[model samples]
Target: MRRNTTFLSAAALAVTLALPVQAQDAPDAATVLARVGEAEITLGHALALREQLPEQFLSVPDTTLFPAIVEQLIEQELLHQHKADDLTRRQRSMLDNEVRNFTANAALSEVAIAAASDEAIAAAYEAFAAEFGQGEPETEYNAAHILVQSEAEIEEVAAELDGGRPFDEVARERSIDGSAQSGGDLGWFGEGVMIPAFEAAVMELEPGEVSPPIETQFGWHIVRLIDRRDAQVPPLEEVREDLSGEIQREAARAFVEELRAAAEVENLATDMDPSILGQRELLDD
Candidate 1:
């Protein structure tokens, strides 16, 4: 169903205001800020308009936003009053759908908020730390390679390296892979990052030592171990916000699964062709 975009836009203004705003003692909702004919725009109306503004516009100072939003609301109210009776059947249906969608969203948001409590977050963080933040440091490798399409080409490259020709210079001249431009520098990576055959070769080498020709899915490679180090886990405070978000998502999924399992649901359209979903004409009915 088609909705009146203008009416939805107005309703969105109210929805945005339902979320928390910047810290300030908000004025009473009844405080009238403007009058367009018999219509009254109050402090609450202006606040809702401010909430609906784009992210870039939010950086605009409240002193600037207050008067501007009031003016915009005044214009919107004037237009809405003039056009209210002209709404189509499709517009009404769409409005009903929008209301249902927003109401469900609001309820789900409350469930998510409640699930992501302080205790839940702490437990999630502890589980994460146990799995990945063990006291043993995570190892990372810094390495380079020369890749070629065949054993013959890899052997030729190895000869060049063995003869003391610079790896970067030879890579720039002959290596077929994209990293050839960067002297085959793969930079730093952790375990499980590289192909098993290539990683095995790398693990066996010391700094400045090169691997004999190794074959993998990609091709043949002569690898050099540049350096290696252990990576430390970041402090809890540094990742708390991200961790909290993950906890909330997991909690919401579990809640939904529980509801689904406990509830009776049926697919009434079992015999209908799925392709019918693409028929926009169905919306007309």
Candidate 2:
């Protein structure tokens, strides 16, 4: 069956976001998905690669995308197979440093993630739910607004609205925000994501109702509630990647803390003026 590009895109993002570091030795390509020659390419690896590809490349049809990536991988493997050994001292040193950094980062990430436990993740989820006021999920607005720095501009826009002029037209004419490009499409967002003042203004308006004007740090906004819906708790399957990262980060911190408690660490000076370094004259000798 052909892979679902959109679903794969989301999955690819999840994998990348969940695990930012790449392991030196990954699952063999043939065993995981399909392979090209001696080089193994797994589905996970493909997905990871697809995530990192440029946006324009991502838009290319998968039929073309797949073969192209295979060819690219084969070329890389071919180069690896016949890499020249001759190198200047500086070149070798640079190579050594690059390899060392890559290995260290990958190994540390693995250790951090592995240290996480099921209980810890569960606790974190519960805490997050509680913080969001885990009451019955309410309707969330996916609205947009044209922001202006002055009340006069806000009133002028309001007048245009009163005169039956399309809000989008006025938005394009006067909005100072980046949203002006798309006629102020802020896209889907839930409560707590926006500033309190903005949220309050949005909450007061009924769906399809446009507000007169509201002020916030960004400036005055004339918001239109484009759409609203009863927000649902995303299934664990939907948000597993984010949860995994959170668990990994917490585990890493806890592990580091435990080690710190068991180790002997001391600061050489209780207090030292950094300016003292400016007076150093021994190096002149």
Candidate 3:
């Protein structure tokens, strides 16, 4: 579903807002641009509306955005003046929810922005480095396989290996798998990359050792172990983006928990039939 749907269509405004824009000194948002009857539409209204737009629409040039946004505000004002007092209960409830959601998000955005400051990021990175460095070096496996339709086909493939035919050579000649073109070589992978049955088979084999026919949902299989190595811990700069995300989440959660502790929130629907939530007619004014 579309996110944060607005009164004006994003696609419609995109075309209208695409007119050429030249650079110029910016004006104050409070500057009045239009009067819808007695109601004034200011640059602030246009700017706020533009800010409310989805990210995909934000790249539209501002000079082009000004007239179109003012026009939209005038239209909105005309509509509201015509019948805003006549809004049905559903429309009013939806508008209330939209305002609540937008304002709450604005508040949480402040917390997240503060949480991801340079000092916070540095502290988070230090903790991550300590915890990450404490773990045993991770192991990786390089393996290959021949996938076949049934037990008989896999056995025939395995028997060819017993006769000293190269695994890759037999794979190309008889294997139905896609990797047959590359000598059935599934290249380097870390632990947990393969399905459980396949991974279990690989771990039991050393380099150059091929397995007996193993069954999985796709069909039967035999895996050959190729090589193994340990993965190194990545440097801080490489993982900074992820670290900052974790910092933001932790701070938001802590702030929310603190608020919850001091609040008197309670659910009043404890005894209501949950299925009543689907009765759309109940929303009628």
lDDT scores in order: 0.77, 0.70, 0.79
lDDT of 3 by residue, 1-285 (tens): 124425665534554442233333785866677777888777787777787777775676766565566667777788888878888999888878878887778777899989898898888888877886686877788888888899989888888888899988887887787888988888777788888999999999988788888999878888888888786556778888998898888888999899899999998999999899899898996
- Deviation of model 2 at 109, angstroms: 2.7
Q: Regarding lDDT, does 1 or 3 come out ahead?
A: 3
RMSD of each: 7.7, 12.2, 5.1
> Which candidate number has the best TM-score?
3
lDDT (tens digit, per residue) of candidate 1 on 155-231: 99999998999988998888888989999899888889998998999899888888899999999999989998886
Point out where model 1 deviates above 4 Å.
1-26, 35-40, 59-64, 82-85, 132-188, 195-201, 208-242, 257-267
Off by over 4 Å in 3: 1-25, 51-66, 135-138, 144-190, 208-213, 219-224
* Colliding pairs, model 1: none
Least well predicted 10-residue stretch by lDDT in candidate 3: 15-24
lDDT of 3: 0.79
- TM per candidate comes to 0.59, 0.49, 0.69
- By TM-score, the candidates rank as 3, 1, 2
**What C-alpha lDDT, on a 0 to 100 scale, does residue 43 get in candidate 1?**
77
Better by TM-score, candidate 3 or 2: 3
